[model samples]
Target: MTEPVPAASAPSGGCPAHADVLPLYGPRFLRNPSELYREMRQEHGPVVPVLLEGDVPAWFVIGYREVHHVLSHPEVFARDCRRWNQWDDIPPDWPLRPFVGYQPSTLFAEGDEHRRRAGAISNGLFAVDQFDLRLRSERIADDLIDAFAGRGEAELMAEYAHPLPLLALAGIFGMPEEETPGLLRDMMTTVNGDEGALDAYQGICATMERLVAHRREQPGPDFVTRMLNDPANLTEEELIADLVLVMTAAQQPMAYWIGNTIRLMLTDDRFSLNLAGGRRSVGHALNEVLWEDTPTQNYLGRWAARPVLLGGQQIDAGDLLVLGLAAANGDPRVRPASDTPALGNQAMMSFSYGEHRCTYPAPELAEVICQAAVEVLLDRLPDLLLAVDPEDLEWSPSVWMRGLVGLPVGFTPV
Candidate 1:
């Protein structure tokens, strides 16, 4: 493995009283976030000040209990961005504007509005047939494997991990196959903050709005239709926002989760042996990945409803607070000292908890997709091995998400 990158020094000294607003989007932070997290926890307790893309200051909650406390108490900490007093201060040209900006989705809603919008999502997901979903996922996996099986070498993240979820979601959303690629490309560009990210994001939302209109004219047994017919009675704008929410929530994280889990299976000897010997299932590998390297590393942006002390830090009513789901999962306080199996332990904060917990079937869907994809690749090319050193694998430079940029592998041509 490559030598670990040294943690970036806090803008001020290491003391909380002189705590620095750490940068969240720099290359240094992405290269060694765990080291930075450890330092943040050691010096600033749970609530540490950090700078977002435009050097916007916000409190980052890094402790296990602190994250739970903030997520659980929505009455004190709200998800509505309208409560953020510093919203006007954030410049429009900020790179993170697309994400941190206000939107009328369930993610940024609170109170009765949140319940209603979230209920629509829950109902749509509940209406899905798990058997059909798994069957489609397996078919997508098989097709993707078939495309590169004879090549004997491929970049799994691009060829397999990234496309699987997008294809499956296209079927779930009842979108035409031909339109899937453009949508995926645009959404990915937007998420990665590439050049013209805002334009790509607009394209994605416009496509979603068009799909919502088409679904209205021609309803089907898809998530969009179900959500449209839901008793929550979401308006046209809200329906489009919800569709965007479902698409973003499902595609990006699912792809990353599958890629990370496969990395663990191929690189970790104990996990590989357990799986090869039938001592552990793909679910076990997935759970380990979720605990150690969750796809959504940081989330749950909550604005303080009023001035209150949290994690020994004083905060104002309109200040923003973010939950460090990844940091909390690895916090020494809640995690066991030894490497214990996490098969049945679903307590990981990959999906935040309480009133605004992730409503999508992320964990279950990720398990199904990863299991299908990995099994096909291994069965088709048993000698598959990493093409580059494991340490050289590049991670996407996303502050809110943890994902590999690509995973290259080589094997004997079949």
Candidate 2:
């Protein structure tokens, strides 16, 4: 990683003189931020400063030009939040940062340790020569869609959304169906991380321990089995860590966004009409969903390795940094090149930018789910519509991840 850009010097005045701005403080700015962001962008132009960081003082970066510059410059910016994300490292005064319990999945890990595990998993999980793995995912998607199609007016979240990816995950890891219930509990624990949640993380660690031992003893064709069969590829610990990150990261947002895609279409007539056409148009619809409706809301939470000056702003060392992805994606300046008023474009930071981008990009993940989820549902029940109004749905109170608490949709009997 590059050394941080030197912090700009200033006189007795609180902030640097290069820019005229006040530190932003508002609940709406932190919580339901879209409205506040729009106002800030309009008034502040390309520089909108705000307070953030779970346990440290920092600036929330919320401008098109500034955010792009900061994200592109990773040396100064590192995704090393060991100070806040880890259990013991958290300061005694503050509550544990939500979702810190299960994050830092080798995805959030940095340096050689990160590269070794991420590379190992990337190779093992996505070795293109393994055509059988791709076929397995497709088959799993098909079976899942078929099951949901049979039920008219299914609650997409409970019936189809959450279950499909969990099934796919089971196939990839070679875990038994009987064990998935315990696994899901562990997965949800990651979402509501606490001391108890951290304890559940240990339960996950134990599950992985048992599974790895089993894989070592009885190697098979599944991902873990394949890696264990040829131990030369990665160290045993690296393999275990990657498995944990891959399984947990893969399941959480995949299921939520798959369900949310259908939710967006149900909420808006334009999105619905776009999906009514041929399969190729699915890409456009998916892009629209990613830009307009995000599952994992912000770029990964990051901490400064040292004091740095970025995008013409000075950030002190150890300060927190939040890249407000949803705001950037909606910023009118970087909107997609479409004749119609585009809801969003893929360049949007929804999947994030920089070294810590989501392992599964939104467009690709959505394409797979849409092809599998939509094909079955659309054919079986052509008139499916949302049971709840878009405005009425409750989203995660979470400022970091903009996901629906529940998305209720209904379909006529086939």
Q: Compare the candidates by lDDT and give the number of the best one.
A: 1
The worst-scoring run of ten residues by lDDT in candidate 2 lies at 2-11
Best by TM-score: 1
TM-score of each: 0.93, 0.78
lDDT (tens digit, per residue) of candidate 1 on 237-271: 89888788778777888889889988887888866
- Deviation (Å) of 239 in candidate 2: 2.9
Q: Name the runs in model 1 displaced over 4 angstroms.
A: 1-19, 274-279, 336-338, 360-362
Cα lDDT, all candidates: 0.80, 0.59
lDDT of 2 at 410: 71
